[model samples]
Target: MATESTMTEARPEGKKLRANVKPAPYRIPQAPPMGWSPTGSKRREWVSRGMVGTIMFLQAVLTLRLRNSPSVGEVHTLTDYRSTPFIQGNESIYPTIVDALGITGARFFSLLCMLACTAMVYSWSRRLFNERVGLAAAFAFAVIAPTLVVGALATVDAFGLALLALATWLTIESRQGPAWPVFLAAPVAALAVVVNYSALYYLPVVTLLALLVSVRVVAPVMAAARTAPLVLVTIGMAAFTASVTSNQKMPESEDIGTLAEGTFHWLGLITGLALAGAGFYVKRARMGEVPRGYDEEPPGIGWRIMLGVILCLPPILAPVFLTLTPSVAPLWKPPLAYSALFTATMAGVGLVRIVGRHFRFPQWGIMAAVALLSIGMAQSSYEYTLWPNASRLAEVLATQVQPTGKYLASDPETINYYLKDKTKPTQWTPTSAGDPTKALKKMTFDLVVLERPFLSKADEALEAELRDSGTYRILNTVPFRLGWTRGTHEIWIANDVPVK
Candidate 1:
């Protein structure tokens, strides 16, 4: 024994012999324990929930105040229940509801959809980050002027946004348990894509969520199996795009394009391929079978996802501004509210984290900042596209136009809504197409109304045509205010020298 001890331990204190320690056994990553945990203190949770609820309530009350407002006056009408490909599904929804309950019901439905979207935003952020962040996101969404204005209109944007938020929430929930939630997300995503081509941009996000949830809940092989539904989503979107493009009625509708136009351009396709490759890499890397406590450590994959999404807000929100461009734009005009809410929520979260960790600033500072952002954004969005005096404009046009006369107007829908109540029986030509001197050379309109300064190329051309044509005389120039934008609409009568 003494000899053995001397051989094992008699090594000098300064110079130790190498110890034999085998490397840790290779273990596969195990699934996270399935459950839900409420984030943040109980008091804070109640406070956040209360604040979000109050904001939604206030927004609803404000919507009631603007009940007469023709928010979607120019877009949605009985004649053309649907305008853009994005709201194709909404064609059935809007016309049916509006035909039954009138415009008020349509606005109410939109408001309800927006409220649901706001609630989903709160729930998603609350589950992923914390109750405070969720409240901030909800508040931001609720206060955005576009959110309220668009929601109060009879448009599909609010409904599509609601569906997207629901799909996102379900995708996150898929990680907590059954794969059915993930499967359910596929159809929801497909519906959103059909409703608005711009919504196709969300396909990558849904695919990523499915892959993450699958890898965490099932084996790597199972992850691929779960992700198969993503292919179906892609196919569904492609079909919808093709079908919409095929149904163009106009000789040269600006919206005429192939399946991979605008939001689904080559850039989007490449980005989607990269996401698929990343998912495959994630699957291969996690093939080892480990225990279920993979999320016990700090900054787990879930936290990384949340952080990544927060960081991506800039790029994600930037594309929304593209709606201002006419040449190449998304079918459904982007409701800037989504980006505004995302930015405000991210800002709120960052400010709170910084203030709490470094400056010891009051928590109220975060709420204040969020409120200010919400109020300002909402104000900016109010009446941004709405013609407040559209009813008056319709009445004036009706008075000037004879029951049997053909009157050309910029927007038929706006005039149609007012005409619904008016006893006028005038026929209106909604096209703004005409050459400066040649368009009306063969055609004769009893009256023409041109809204200026013209934003549409065709409308500008028609306006110049009417002004330059010697056969027409300007009767009256009616001026109107569309929120911040101001314009004058000219009423022109054909100069008819009596044939007698």
Candidate 2:
């Protein structure tokens, strides 16, 4: 060993230096851009985390209140329970869950999913920007009326959105190592599609965004990993859309005025802070302030997305807005859940940066705009929660209609759920089968329920028919509160039931 060392010592000093030195890695990960951390005390990170937790707590409280509200449940809430199964296969035993735990319990499962989405949004926003931005993004998403609505609903939207967000987080995180995360992303996205068909709409947009990020932040996305999911989701979405349209009933006439108002709310429903943040992001991009550890004129991939969105969204959203028609609206009319989520993420980044005086803008101006918009957003959200419920109709039905008796209703959607659980025979006639009045005349129904306050022309005729005919007698007209509005459930009983 000494002889070898002596021989080595005789070697040139330059050669020794070369031997000791290590070569650069074949695939070095990109370094975080300068100013990755926001300009603040280190405590900001902890403060942001705490704030996020508080927002989460507030969301949970709101969801619980909605759940425990006097209303039995939304008409669409329990309808989703059957869809919990996948491809109508044995893989999902979710229907049993509805039977075992009921509406509240199923909705609780969706809550867990919604919370997961919130967590993923935080992680993703934090990774792309900073903790404060993450908190802002999380706040933006949590406060969305639809987000809150889904939290209290036992629907597939929350579950599918959660998985989609998870897949997004995993795909973006691939920048750290470019190995496992990228590989797992496609499978999770696929599962999300399978879980909720709605997810299929936003998959391509998100996948494209992920591709841009993956390539810019760290090049060479795992071979076919990103593109494969997009192609599959596209094909699956088309197939599902065709199947849904083909099997479903023809569209019932809607109040175009109402749909238009709802669409307007969706377009402008984002909180004032989020809108401000999005504007700030655009402002920074225009100023060439490339701060988010990525490349190009618009600062980063996220900024580019915003630019594309601004240019593209108006064309698609305009028809729906201008026409006051649901027929012309695309699936993204309400902003597909994932699309809304990403917009919220950007808004979060924008809000934090805007509030920080990053652009030297007036603080009071920003606060005022945000406060006003936030109020508008809150109002729109409250409006969305005001669908007519069947709590009183349900109560009246229990006492008036016999368990196995024939029943028909003018607006039978919500009442169907109550009758489904309580009644033995499931041969109930609804508005879909044509005029409830004609159905009552053609076939004897033991009970007829007609909703009132603002009835359709046909519904008015039906109510008149029921009243004029001596064969039917009014059992009761129970007044019920629909959020802030008042309505009545007019229950009519046949003169005789099986006169035995």
Candidate 3:
């Protein structure tokens, strides 16, 4: 004990010893985990905005190029401007919008509509979700093959969808922020209905979305007051549209499936579920626990689940509802043709989450894939421009056949458009009352134009009937290139042609 002198030694040795002791395991600083982050820098916002603009520009250019590709099927805008209430409304709006923009051609009108839709998609998505999700949504809308084809056409579908997007944006804003925006949604909904009769189908889905937001988070009294006007206006528009267009033929139950095919599918369902699940986990993991005083966060998992259900239901119900042949036929027709923005937004969000979480792909990499896939899909249908073959056939008929006669056309819409200047010939499809065979046998046509693969399922026996009928003879069988195959049409001349 005596030998243990309490010496105050020079502390330099202690410092040297501590310095050489390998400070706290020399770990390299770990980088922050990558996932959903609500906050972003101004530079990021600018970059996203630029990307959206670039994508919209690309879509506009492509749409403008396809302006002359020909109109196939029943795009309401392609119909005669004065024939039906829907067509008249579409035509009336077209000139005003074009005049406002100072655009001279129909192509520019289509471009403008497509641009509006793209902008709405980006704006609504970004406001509701994040810039990343919004960018992805815009990218999806830009790159999808069907969206390009439909959006490029001079149809009310794009405009209708644009209005729908606007209404949706307003409704979401009203629920999340101000009460006034909900009132604005009412007028937008009415405009959507006026733009396209098919907008009726979308109304229910949107109402469901509004209810989801309003009932849960918003004040009940305020939500009710805001919602009542929207519902009433929507109903009023639907009734008015039905009354105005009562005479228009309902698209066949079978054809309705074709309209909604792109949106509602098993792949979309699977992808949606994956998206919701992944997003839920990632967000929960990042947020950990609800912060002490943080408000204005992105919607919770419950909202995500509800949204997924909303987006997925239309596609599933479309085919079934159309199959039933409801009395309100317009309501049964697949609504997604004009509601593509919503579908694309849902798809985009899911795709981005999946790519980032599952495959560990960076944002740029995901975008590259989206672009390439879109280009590939669109390019695959290069030669099969809608109605080009039909238009060319119309030209052949004008020069080759005498125009004075009742003509039976496989597709009256195309023939009508191409033959608008010729008044001598009147074209009609097989009558609505009877099968094609019976209808053709009953009525004597000067010319019968039959395209392979009958447009209507009930008209499947048309070719056989034409071949067996002794009153007619095949004058010409014109073959048109349709993608990888050639589609041939038989033009039959009545045996009782007047001798000139």
The number of the candidate with the highest TM-score is 2
lDDT of 3 by residue, 34-64 (tens): 4434466788888988998898887766655
- Residues 1-500, candidate 1: write the lDDT tens digits: 47987766655466554455345579778764544433356787777778888878976765555543454432453444355333334356546666776676767888898888878778876664556556655665565565666676765566667777677778767776688877888888888765545456556656775776567668878877777787678677867766765665422223324322433331232223223323332333221222345423333555455444642443244344333221112123235543443344454354344345334776655555555545545453544443545656676766655555566777655676677554232466665444423546655567677777675888877777776767787877777775567778777778882221
State the number of backbone clashes in model 3. 1
Which pairs of residues collide in model 3? 264-315
- Tell me the tens digit of each residue's lDDT in model 2 across 229-347: 65676677657655754554432324556544554465354434455565666555432344544442234646555544642353234334333211211122332344456666666
Q: Model 1, which residues run further than 4 Å from truth?
A: 1-46, 61-77, 81-91, 213-219, 246-297, 301-333, 337-348, 357-359, 363-375, 378-388, 420-426, 436-443, 455-474, 483-485, 494-500
Q: Rate the local accuracy (lDDT) of all candidates.
A: 0.57, 0.59, 0.59
Worst 10 residues of 3 by lDDT: 325-334
Clashes per candidate (backbone, < 3 Å): 7, 1, 1
CA lDDT of 99 in candidate 1? 74
How well does candidate 3 score on lDDT at residue 158?
A: 61
Listed in order, each prediction's TM-score against the native is 0.68, 0.73, 0.70
Error of 3 at 349 (Å): 3.4
